[model samples]
Target: MVMTIGLPTQQKTRNNQLYVEHLSDDIQDHVYQAILEGVYKMFQMFGGSLSEVLADPSKKGKLKDFLDWQIPRLRVQHADLLDVFQGVQFLPLDKHAFLRVQCFVNRLEGRFGEIR
Candidate 1:
């Protein structure tokens, strides 16, 4: 009934419980934790392969932007308007812009490891 997503950190924080749960002892690499129960299951249900459209060359532009810094910043910024807005400056994306990012989400399934 819930959904979880990963947003890599530019700087580490001591306060996040998700980071604590996922980090291996060495700390150089860590898995991302999904707050959602069903998200990992749904991703596995998709056959564990890139979609035909995503593998095609024409989707490169969409993939590039999704891999870039802009998209994640926008997601974080969406959470708390005044706090996110305070002294922060970044390019913005409109509501319709997210239609293209699903491919990137699909690619994340085995990336940080599944929930179970």
Candidate 2:
């Protein structure tokens, strides 16, 4: 039996972590494209309307709840991958987006009190 096309080979050892074994340059490119497509799909799935997600009091609070609860859990789940971006870098839009989300979280936390 052979595994191909979006299926990763599984190993019995090492707590069952799968690797993209023997990926050529083209297979690697395919993997990268798949990841980008998935990311955008997720954004669209979670973000119905940009204005609603980024604005509107109720909608904004939901997004803040998601970021607070989920992002830290994701960090725990995928720490190795996230380490690639461990360095601090300056970009206007990135900083703006962070500030917007942070401001929303700050407001929400102040309003609702801490998660504890």
Candidate 3:
């Protein structure tokens, strides 16, 4: 059995063909690609499971640097990264405000098809 994970461009391309039998059209959004790239880099540096990697003796120090430094820096650089993969919740707004935004989104969707 095999497992698949995403990563950044540089790491992903290093041995991309070996991982995929047939590639599809590349993802168009730069943000999504960047997120994938980040995941790839983590996998390369820490292996599969984040907890398992942190538990290893050799990886313990690197884990501290990653948790303390890299994560905060990444959050500053990519504010949406943590939120991107999370489940959605209702906006913190009154009913009227929520309806207004929903109405605007509906209009935009009418004009542009769908968001994606």
For TM-score, the strongest prediction is: 3
What are the per-residue Cα lDDT tens digits for candidate 2 across 1-116?
Answer: 11134434434545577544542432444334444444444555886654667567768776566556544453232333223444356665687898997898888988887632
TM-score pick, better of 1 and 3: 3
10 residues in a row with least lDDT, candidate 1: 28-37
Query: Candidate 1 — which residues are off by over 4 angstroms?
Result: 1-49, 70-116
lDDT of 3 by residue, 66-93 (tens): 5566544554234354435442566599
Ranking by TM-score: 3, 2, 1
Tens digits of per-residue lDDT for model 1, 1-116: 22245544444556563343343332211122221222233433442323643567676565454336333444432444343234366456665665445556666764756822
Better of 1 and 2 by TM-score: 2
The backbone clash count of each candidate, in order, is 0, 0, 4
Clash pairs of candidate 2? none
Against the true structure, what is every candidate's RMSD?
19.8, 19.8, 12.6
TM-score of candidate 3 to 2 decimals:
0.29
What TM-score does model 2 achieve against the real structure?
Answer: 0.27
Winner by lDDT between candidate 3 and candidate 2: 3
Locate the minimum summed-lDDT window of 10 residues in model 2.
74-83
